[model samples]
Target: MLDDATLRQLSKTRGQTLERLRGVFNAGVGGDRIENMLYRLIGNKDGSRDLQGLAEVLQGRNVKLWVVSAGTNNLQKKKGLVDADVDKMRLLLDTLLKISSRTTKMLFSGLTYRTDIGDQLVDEANEKVCLLIMAMNQEFGYARIEYLPPVADLDKGQHLADHVHLNERGYQMWAEILAPRVMELYGS
Candidate 1:
């Protein structure tokens, strides 16, 4: 039960207050666009200070922006269209490329293992999600593709817990494998 002034103040505060509760209720309806508002405020033409801006200050050079996403389902839901999700992802990528053609590279990976006690249905859903990931890479030529082979069963435990999330060791290895490719693409 917020009044207009309180609602306006909440919107101005970037959702750190109860007045901003409207944002939570309106979540996922252009959620990406909404989230980008935070990014916009920090270190760009926007009026907020953030890490990216600080790096630009320290380096005495403009900081380039790059986004690497994993576990994006936490950010945006595909509404259980598990099988066709990849295609939808591809369409979104295409739109992004159109807007920001400067995006130099993308590093896409497939699900390699799972041991979560969540449910069998989620495991099956992940497999379908992986299929979409593969399809997205194949369908579009926006960025270089580097296929990371699934780790063998013995090595899977080193990289994954509950067959899905990366353990520290696995993430370290994943970063090691991905870093060179990303560096080469960005010419870093």
Candidate 2:
């Protein structure tokens, strides 16, 4: 793996600002010295917070269904997806699946399309996300990991505030999508 200074120089050489490099990368892009360039550029996240979030869910409460959604914002940062990103994503979801009761249903939705960033970037990220979720379902051999592809026919500029966040209408639309599935696992 390239050292931080080396990556910093590489970033500078490429004229890519650290702020803009928040998405993803792999050794494949940089050859030998770069192993998961995303982690280096973004700073090692350590995933403590991710683990903590899961821990909180495990505390006393009964959670029959875990509705998980994330990754679009950072995914918007970089131009390409990498294998390390996929590995990290798999590890995170794998932990949840392994620890949670087998009967528990997990519903993970693909990243949303964004007009804030180029739709191309978000759309690309969304595809990687969709693929990872599918892979996780297959690899974990769990029948309960349900995936909802992003909605069709939703007006992004209208439904999203700042073309990224959910406006009131967006929230309603999202709820409509989630409700039936939630009811399926959670009941009335």
Candidate topping TM-score: 2
Tell me how candidate 1 scores on lDDT. Answer: 0.38
Give each model's whole-structure lDDT: 0.38, 0.54
Candidate 2: list runs displaced more than 4 Å. 1-62, 77-82
Q: Quote each prediction's TM-score.
A: 0.42, 0.63
Write the residue-wise lDDT of candidate 1 on 1-188 in tens digits. Answer: 11233224323432132222111212122223312423322346544743452223323222222223322232223233243444555544343333333443444443344444333443454565556545655666433333343333325446554444455555555544544554555454
Show pairs that collide, candidate 2: none
Checking candidate 1 for backbone clashes, the offending pairs are 113-163, 114-162, 114-163, 115-162, 115-163, 116-162
Q: What is the lDDT of residue 88 in candidate 1?
A: 50
